[model samples]
Target: MSDFFEALPGAVGSPPQHYGNPLGEQKILVDGSAVVDLGHRGIVTVSGSDRLTWLDSLTSQSIAGLQPGDSGETLQLDINGRLEYAIRVVDDGDTAWLLVDADEAAGLLAWLSKMRFMLRVELADRSADFATIGSLGTPAIEAAAPNGVPLVWHDPWSSVVRGGHQYAQVAEHPGAEWSYSETLVAPSALAAASALPVAGTLALDALRIAAWRPRLATEADEKTIPHELDWLRSAVHLTKGCYRGQETVAKVHNLGHPPRRLVMLHIDGSDGVLPAPGDPVAVHDASDIADAAIGTVTSSALHYELGPIALAVIKRGTEHDAELAILSDGIRIAAAQEVIVPRDAGAEANVPRLPRLGAVRR
Candidate 1:
């Protein structure tokens, strides 16, 4: 977005892709002392004494208890609870700040304004007023967040949060130590990042996917629900008061199966090529033409440590040990499924048997 950024030394790439040395830069960026200009991200601010309650009533998180300097995430769904947008949020007493996709900023702002009604809330799309900077391991926004409140939304994906559930049966999440932060900065603050080793969306994405992070850019679909991407880890609070899509969420989580489930694919790197998003994912069969695609690749990246890896949403009925193949740019690449969301995702079948009568643990 800034020609100035392109001209910086080692800043040698375009937006929405890799910049600088990806792996080398990643080490620096994650150290918490460096910054990554999330220019592709947008910012919105909701200010007023009523901001917390108003937002809590509209989204899928329990945010009325959010205090100044507190941070979290929320989802905006349609009346039927289909996702419309995802937001990273923080409140600094005077303002409730939102970090969202830049492309959706205008629409989200307009929607929020129309919903104000008689509420004492003030809303503004502040993308023009501020830029976003991200860091992990330490606080890089101290120089920018004047209040020293951080205004940083710490990522809570690593642990099972209150009112949330985990679908990944792994004892420890690969991203368990993924302590990251994103904060608002003025254009002037971008100067701070220019001097540090730089990493871009591409680097961030590779690490994110490897950690099994469900990002809106890749994981969400038209009919996508929280259960599919295991997003309930942080974004949805089950015990929270009703919000749009809450009924659908509850119905599916408690009684129904998410038609599809997310998985990680360890793509064969023999060709040294990667599949693009939406590439057809078919059942792997060397003996015949691959059966009709059972799923599609949602995101793919060549991680420095894991090599070619991807995330896909396949039918929940797909065998957990199914061999998969991805058709990419005309070449068929082999893929092995690493279960992220179990096949029986929506059903919790571990109900223990009763001792004397048909009783169960509360």
Candidate 2:
């Protein structure tokens, strides 16, 4: 927790988790009546004529043509297409502000510095100059326009953008109503915000989980790819020109399937214990194995409307209707699966497989 977070009244935990009313906070937050102190978030600024094009040459989003006040989410993937950084970016004409979890800020800055060989871009960690505040509407954030442009970054997760894909097979995605945004404010503005009803990260995360939002900080592992979490819906642009990890992304979405897929688990809360992240999710009915684990829970929360729910990543072959169990602290809890990324998600081009040279044509 930063000094800013510690100073908030009624705050709890090392990095305050809540003001002792997370559930209640969620209720009010949805209606834009409350604000969440996101002081733990980090901000980095990039300024230069080459900033936009340079960023376009990197990351997974198509932002080279981004105009001032345009907000988007982009993923920084490793050479092999594994996620490294999930960046929320907003440009204010003079600079591009990159927002991320605090732990990722330093590394993201370092990586950008290393890549700015001949570019005119300059980078800085502006976390000390600003704090982050989250809200569902612009009323709380619209006044923080330092450069005559509000720094609030409206999330693009509500719908699929051009060149993006949706893997979740549902009549309506829970994220359609997720109108979340993070705004950067000065220290004075942050202090003045104490007058508003305050929520904590716990409340924010609960709403996020119910919305089926994939957070890179919690959901990603070394082997995880965008396709597995349906990240392409917001972060990756399929028709964009070449960038890091673009080949692997194209290959997976066109010719192959992601090894794993994300799912939402509606947990049975009779035990009164919610499963934690990294808990093993297994098939409830086993054949030969004693306890066969299928996937691992990535995040869990007691949702205001959904009771207890979690997001887990399971094998692509796991049956969509499989009865699932989560092993948390030696307690086996039954869970019902909600398909996120379907089993047949990839191979979008649907090219036919060719017969082997040694085999006769059928």
Candidate 3:
């Protein structure tokens, strides 16, 4: 656990999620000054002269133009184009700071180390050396950015990145005003945040779910594609030169459809129970929970402002206007979908006179 988490008054434990005053602390986070200990988060550093270009050539985002203190994010895909890793990054001239989920850090570090063949890059897991402090507003996190290796990854969920596309056609994305940041802090800085009331993932998730932000830790499945969650808005640079799995990314965006789409659900929380991740979400066609589920909850939370909300990845074939329900704690909670990635997303939408679904195969 991070030192800051240890200093939290009611921090029960770590992993899976943290414990603290979620609803109460959420207010502190939004009202200008609360520091959150990112317990299950991990840190990795890549240092060398070839760092920028090397990373630029490897991931989904264009990192060649990275400058000192600049924040960005990227994804590592398998040769088959499946999402293998996701990272939040910031460069400090000499090194690249990568913040990721704790469970995935070893895999990311090992993969980076093994891929360093001829490149001058050096990879190190700095999870033990440094911790992360999160805040929705700048007041608390700004003061904790490491002085020597100062780096803060400001989230880009709000706007489209250069060379990337947005699948969300709404005039104003709820995330457009999203002002979240994660600051890298060492032991001393962690201690500095001790006085700040602590909160758990619930508080952070409420805001994130409301914004329709997809996270690597919670939203990933083996078959996950970046387009499914509209991650291109921040993580994938479409026109960037070749990298692993670029072909699939380009093909899907330009000529195919994402098999699944992301949606935000307003759950009926009258029963006072929040569905956890992995809960089955079904189309409310017949009120029976036994029917095959259409999707799975990626993350859920009881928002202080919005009652209850969740992000779910559902089959794209599911109708956009379909009523949905999540079966939880022996009760089905009714849900309404707020599209994040529209049902008819992708370049295929513009294609006309196409044959039936399996015509070519036949």
Candidate 4:
């Protein structure tokens, strides 16, 4: 057994293991815990004289309300109010850090820079200078950390401070008992720090699916408005002033109902294989596929706790708990709807309606 697994009590006796493939010889030893190399997650540093004000004007969240030690979630949307990127912002005195999914960082940075030609804010890609790890449901191991590391307790999840400067983001799930912690560390000392069992991108995907957390470039589509993805409560500040996409955001929330809704998929064990992202999800009525395609699968994972699950965006009013099928590469996978929220409920009726824009689309 590896030292990392050995350090875990009782884990060495009967370590959880999973086969990478049904017919593959190699097996992945599950330690009941795993560390994800979040190197792919990128960080953006916004500093200079007007960092806070500048960011506040651009993002969907209220930046001025943030305190020195606090963190908040925000989204950057295009002029049409389509979500471009989602970020977790942490404030530390004069500088604020924006952490975003790895794939969307470059595009988001470029867009922000273009709008920052004369602004006092400076934007730099600090992804290469930092390391991040996400640990879930393993409080015992985190509680055993040495005192030297700066640890921040945000209720359900705690972050171990690594490197010279550290910042942590913690949040509790609204309807679930799960807790998540995201820790940012300086790249220089990351390799030497005590290792946590590493979880591959696959494991993280499964965890997110089970949690029903929506992500950008996947669960969120180019046609998706923030309200449709149910991101307003956490990602957007409705009270905040004008932004690139505020008008559309408000309109959708108030007057218009989002054409699509985020849904969870419970895949049947009898299916031959799980569908990948971008696969078309449809309703199977006896012998024929439904005429109207329901939605697209964004992320799919084999959950450690819930077997096979996926997060998808389906048309609103679709029947919950109804059996469906996901098709990809001539293979049909069986799926069922698991609604995250009912169609007509809290916050849906109160969203502000779009103001008249006089012939021109805002």
Candidate 5:
């Protein structure tokens, strides 16, 4: 058993407890005056005469409205409106920096480059040159941004700001009332901040699951659309002009309902284990497991405060209080549904419906 799992009380399973680095309690990182290292987050630069217009036409958010020093989250969709990538777009007057998942940076750059036939847009990966760090809670926020610079404090997600000439500070998984900032500092400064515990990718994943925030590739699937994940208000811009797959976004949102939907899962902590991403989540009361398969687990974690929690994508009408299960090699892990977004939000009401999935009509 790895030191990480050896320190824990649960039994270590097939996938070794440490696939990468064993991030200890140091995973959370905060300790009065400590600095921590944020795992793989990369930056993509988009520059050209038609940068704004080109990006505006491709992403789900309204990039045309972005002003200098402003940043927002946007989704890059495939031809069918399926999410290819979720990125934080930051405009710094001269260049537009896209902060994307490290794993997707190369693919995103290649895809965007191929599509730039005549458009004056250049896309390049800037991951090696930047470091992303998370600064959370009241103290971290104050320390990161001492002077209120007319910044927007949107909660339950990360936000960013360029530091010096080569660094940017971004927020990561801002949960409920808690706040965090992802600092993109220079590599030289990292050693100075080494005293701060380095946070592992697992900790960030757990934080995201606990907060019920959907992640790319995990919570989001090719068959899945943003609206079903309740990303309309955050990642999609209903008022924005046309983009690839805008038709599907408009059609489903205005005339049809998404086949599946995202929801929160609160696991029975007594079970002593949490389900991994891609695990099947079943409705326990059903006689046939296949028939009751409502969704797949996207992200999950054992929170210090919330115990085992997860974000899942289930059929729209699945009973909220229905008993849930995570099946792995004949082992049935118990779970329960916990609705994060209310069914009757005004924004969801405006969604157009067609071939509805018994989606609630407000």
Candidate 6:
């Protein structure tokens, strides 16, 4: 931990959620003049000649072809195709750096270690060796190069990569304007980096939600599939050969729709309180006797540009034009849904459907 960050005014918690002014910090951060302390994140390193191929065989993205300084994101799914892990990957030829949520590092490392039976790959949890700092522009800190490899992971959410698919049909995606990256630097360098303009996770998250970026820590539940978040836009390689859960991925994209879809909520801030994750997202019946549970708020933030916005995952059958409401702490906050993944998304192969077994031909 950086003594400078710990001693900063209004600093609190292990990661310093904010330094006095979160919204102000967000404003500067969006202007590309501030860095956010992300020391709470976790880092893992994979090395060995087979590192790339080994990862390729286990993840949703095509990793075998990544070269030095190449960046990508990948997902680890359960056999049923529910998301288990989401990883930010950057390769430096000799080693691959994996940046993940702090809570996920240990479990991910254990899972990977169990899978490395005969592969000549080595894995290490490097969170203690380096701290993560994020910026909207190029990283403000000089990245560490302990092994002659600069460790910085440029975010790929700005655009879809090859073999990746986008489910959103908007004329323009908000993520196009997002320029985010995370840099790993020595703990000793944090104090020096903190000398520059600084933001906090709250600011970073507000920007992230505005960008329509799906973060694993919040966006995913045990039942989440990549398609629901449109994660294939930058994370999954649809054409990539077999990997864990690939079967379900291909099947869903080719012939089925995800049971749920992601949406951005323009929350009514009249209550002067932001809705937290897991809040019920619903719609009132015409009689007003009941409220239909459509989804749950997954992430929420007060963005500098957009106030009190949130992301939710709702039932695929939820009417797109329906008026939505968020129930938080016994207060009902009206919300307007901005579609992230359209209800009609998927079945990209356009396979012709067959008539029902008992249907009579007209």
Q: Write the per-residue lDDT of candidate 4 for residues 5-46, one digit (tens) a residue.
A: 324333312122221331111112133354444555777878
Worst 10 residues of 1 by lDDT: 139-148
Q: Would you list the C-alpha lDDT of every candidate in the order shown?
A: 0.80, 0.87, 0.83, 0.62, 0.61, 0.89
The TM-scores of all predictions, comma-separated, are: 0.91, 0.96, 0.92, 0.75, 0.75, 0.96
Q: Candidate 1, 122: how far from true, in Å?
A: 0.5
Better of 2 and 5 by TM-score: 2
lDDT tens string, model 3, 203-268? 777888888899988998999999999999999998889999999899899888899999999999
Number of clashes in every candidate structure?
Answer: 1, 0, 0, 3, 16, 0
List runs of model 6 lying over 4 Å from the truth. Answer: 284-291
Off by over 4 Å in 2: 1-9, 287-291
Error of 1 at 337 (Å): 1.1
Go through the candidates in order and give the C-alpha RMSD of each one to the true structure.
4.2, 1.8, 3.2, 8.7, 8.5, 1.6
Whole-structure CA lDDT of model 3: 0.83
Q: Candidate 5: misplaced stretches above 4 Å? A: 1-36, 137-178, 287-291, 341-362
* Residue 225, model 2, lDDT: 90
TM match of model 1 to true structure: 0.91
Candidate 5 residue 190 Cα shift, in angstroms, is 1.4
Please report the TM-score between candidate 6 and the true structure.
0.96
Among all candidates shown, the one with the greatest lDDT = 6
Tens digits of lDDT, candidate 1, 1-362: 35445676666555525465777656665665656667777888898889999999999888888887888888898876677888888888878888887888898999998899999999988887766766776553443464456567778777777888888889878878777777676667666655665577777777788888888867887888888898888888988898888998888887778888899999999998798899888789843323588889999988887889999988899898889999888789999999998977765545565587766647
Residue lDDT tens for model 2, 1-362? 24556577778864557888888878988989788777678898999999998998999999988888999999999998999999999999889999998889999999999999999999999887887888876545434576778787999999998889999989999999999998887777656676677788888999998888999889999888999999999999999999889999999999999999999999999999999999988888754222587789999998899999999999999988899888888888999999999999999999989888899875
Off by over 4 Å in 4: 1-34, 137-175, 286-292, 345-362
On lDDT, the stronger of 2 and 3 is 2
